[model samples]
Target: MFVIDVIPFARFAPAGALSYRFNEYVLPGTIVSVPLRKKTVPGIVVACTSVRDAKESIKTAPFVLRSGAVTTTGILPKSYRIALTKTATYHLLPMGVILREMIPEAFLTHGFPKKLFAGTGHSLSFCEKTYTLRIEEYKKIISCTKGTVLIVVPTAVEIDRFADTFPSAIVVTGALTQKKRLASLKKIKDADIIITTPKYSFIPIPHLAHIIIERESANSYLTVARSPIDTRIAINALAHERSMQTTIGDYPLRMEIRPKPGSALKSISASPIKIFDVRKKITQAPFKALPEQILSIIKSTHEQHGRSAIFAVRRGYASTVICRDCGTSVRTTDGRPLSLITVAGKRVFRSSNGDTVIDAKALCDKCGSWNLIPIGVGVERIAEAVRNNFPNAPLVLFDTNTIRTPRDARSASTKFDIPGTIIVGTEALIPWLNPSNPISLAVVASADSLLALPFWRTRERLARLAFSLTERAEKVAVVTRRPDDAIFTTLENRLDNAFFKEEDSMRKQLNYPPYGHIVTIRIESSITKIEKDTALVQSMLKPKTGIEIPDRYATQNKVVRTIVYKYIDIQKWSDEAQELSQKIYRLPPNITVRIDPESLW
Candidate 1:
């Protein structure tokens, strides 16, 4: 029987190299059931090999393999596989976990893909908001008049709105359920018009057509977990394989050019990134800052035949619980707040099974008062605040707590049937860029909250957010105590094009990614002390490679630290990365290590 290398479908579990033998004839990229924990779970077949490193004493030695019947299930293109390996190695995550995101979950399984509009596609003769024909957009479809058209956008908001305009297209996104997702993917292969998120383009299409990125520079296009797989790289792959030229707005081009020359050179025309700075509007809002600026703006904007949105960072109602007598937030050791609930019109405990409510028997550590109040509003709290303030305006709440499904939410927003409503949400609000929705103004009440964080890439993100704000609305009011900070200075200067280069330089100098190589090793073996683990890592590396500690930690049995490798031996580095990752995999049960993490943001 042939042997197969399978990556079992488990995330964040104790990991080991998945080279063990399995059933027969399964091809690469095909999903199959493998033993995991108490039962069998499905996973993608990564490779086929006769190589076996396990001891002869093991019963499963020379494990048999099986070929998956899914259309001669295949490996990703060589380039994409290499990129995927680099990300998995760098992040120290299970290779399979990264692979799971490599292609979508659907095409690997039983169902067929679907097209966006298909038979009921809403044609776009004119812009929904402007009611004016965007003949500029139509030219591509009518002019090509041959190959199928694939229009990709950074967010579902754009996709939902844009897809309906086309008469027969399919919308593919993370929001679609597993069955529907596969249906959409299968059906869209031959579709004339296809709307999709960036990553899934790796799936083959029936024919090559013009590629369009609705708004290019969206942070959604960035690899939240890996750098090389960003939308820019995906487009390059398409161009290389299909000979189709990709189109992007001016925004994404600027970020990519500084990192690598000609990385973003698509012959292009773009609308200007318009800015409506409301720095002056906040001062004119009748107070140094309107305590309820978020709610008031929503009420006023909707009243004026325009829609408005409020953006906050988290879910749930109130963000913090504080003793009114003294300013101290109640929280847990894990950095999550100590949550509360009101049951049946009266106060109750957080969980029926755990912990005591209200420290009636205990004193407040800060003020000795039993009275506790919540501060720091979340998106839900802000929505309720809008309700309290507007009382009469039409309102729509969009957030994790309220919206059950992403597809439903995007579809709801796309309808444009409900006007004069406030869309209050978390990071969900980042994509609502309707150019002619009569959304004349926007208010970022806590825009600086994300900027003020201490993460490595805060400055770059701040600039991106500011640029996006300007592009999203005609008038924007950014609320912050320090309106004159350096980030804002860079953000406010429309003519300042140096932000990318300067920020890129800093990321490089610090040995952060896109500048150099990085890996975070989390050690969990009880027998090994923190210092011993550190030394073990140091001895594993060569004297020539630059390795430095960004941070080190130890809490008895738990130890973790990040190592930066700025100058790599390019010829052998990739191989070394794989070897080291394998060694990490075989480490004792107590150790935990994740390489390049999802957010240093």
Candidate 2:
């Protein structure tokens, strides 16, 4: 019998590139008709090779033969293989698994949609900026070219603008209904240009000449929460396989960046930025009262002056409803701040016990208090405050959910026609404004919170957000408590760009992403002790396995324990890790090991 080589589809192991064989003539990159045990099934062909002579001599085959009937689909382009292999290795995934994401989802089922565009492209450029996109170059491409164009963006907001700019284009995302989705897919298959998110674009299309453009080169956040596959590598692979052209720009280079304390978004009529040190803004703000000053700013912007927006990063009335008496915060057993969940979002927590879902009304584990308050202010809460302060103000609010829709944001950039239209929001809330209206006034409250975190990407993220909003807004004011910290100074001056560069270098030196490879594994058990699990990991991964098992179980709580292993025998370790994970998974109904994590935080 001719042996078949089956390849798992992308969804089978998201963020993982390991291609598992079903033990059957799996054409390269094609779905195969095969048998699993006594049942007929489907599998993908990743690679074809003769059985090794050593193995052949040791074990006699059960009449498995190398026959000419098996077809060759040609080697998946060298660049395509490099991308798949690099993504698999660097992302700490199995080589065979990562290959899955490269294959379009449509090909895994029915025949290929070759009439439509498909394939990956080499990056022409990369931008870490928000809502990244090309400048004059993109306009040039569309004007001269006349083939089916597939342009992928991280958010629908970008797609909306693209649709408007190019009226003939069609947009597709998760928000579309089945009918709309099918229509959009059909449009993708038929139209000259298709603008869609990555997952939705995984149609059965083949032989595509795609132009891969990323305003923000796809990031980990690109993973659809349900499927959790990084579309960056996958889409790039497809683009390469089909000889598609690609252009990447995280954000515009000429865009504003708060490089210095004196610099900030100076209005479209002025410079890219007009930095306002909160220290001085604090002088403008009444020092005697905090919230009152905030309220007054709102009042002035609405009743006393022109339109402006206020941003509060934390959501809910208060982040923590604490006990003033005990001076203690209500917290989880692991010492995380307890939050007050909203009525709708709170009830939805019941759906996922796997991830910690705390109800806002749930009493504080410390000082049982309905006196609970929300610690951080979210976009919704900020919007509510603005609305309450200026009851008669004609304003439109935009958040992650609403900004996601291009139609809903049609008039988002228009100034308060009724005089005092104001928008209050979170970081994401501010970015939805019309790019042309680059002179809007805004206030960013609690922007300092993220600056204080120890995470490697914190500063870059903050800078990106600030840079994006400041460049778009006319006069932007950031009110932060840390007016003297490195982050503050970075925002206060352009010298901070150096810090970002240094940080980038540090990440490179440490072998962290864009520098090295990162794959994290998390194990959980309800009945097992943290110490015992750590001991087992130490014993199993013997010394000089060349794998770095960083100081056992970094953190542990009542529900779970975490251990991080950096740069080791990742492929073999993954297999062994699976066994250990299985062992803990079998502990009891309550114990579970969340395997092959795409994210650590």
RMSD values, in order shown: 8.1, 8.0
Per-residue lDDT of 1-601 in model 2, one digit per residue for the tens? 2234455343333342122323343445554544333343344565554444235632574434433333333334344555555444434444454555445444344444434333344334443333323444566665665566667766766667777877887776666765676666665555666777665544444334546555542242355333245666566555665566665555323221113212232222222333444444535532221255556656766665566766665544344446544667765554555544344534311111223556645665676665544445555556556566667777666654355555666556554344566775566554456555553466666666566554556666665566666546666666666565454555555434544555556655665544334444344543356556556655644552223232322224343444554443434643554444433423333222222343443
Query: What is candidate 1's CA lDDT for residue 143?
Result: 64
For residue 17, what is the lDDT in candidate 1?
A: 38
RMSD of 2: 8.0
**CA lDDT of each prediction against the hidden true structure:** 0.53, 0.50
Question: Per-residue lDDT tens digits of candidate 1, residues 5-102?
Answer: 66654554343335545435555655565665555555566766543433342446464433333223344444445555566665445566566655
How do all models score by TM-score?
0.67, 0.67
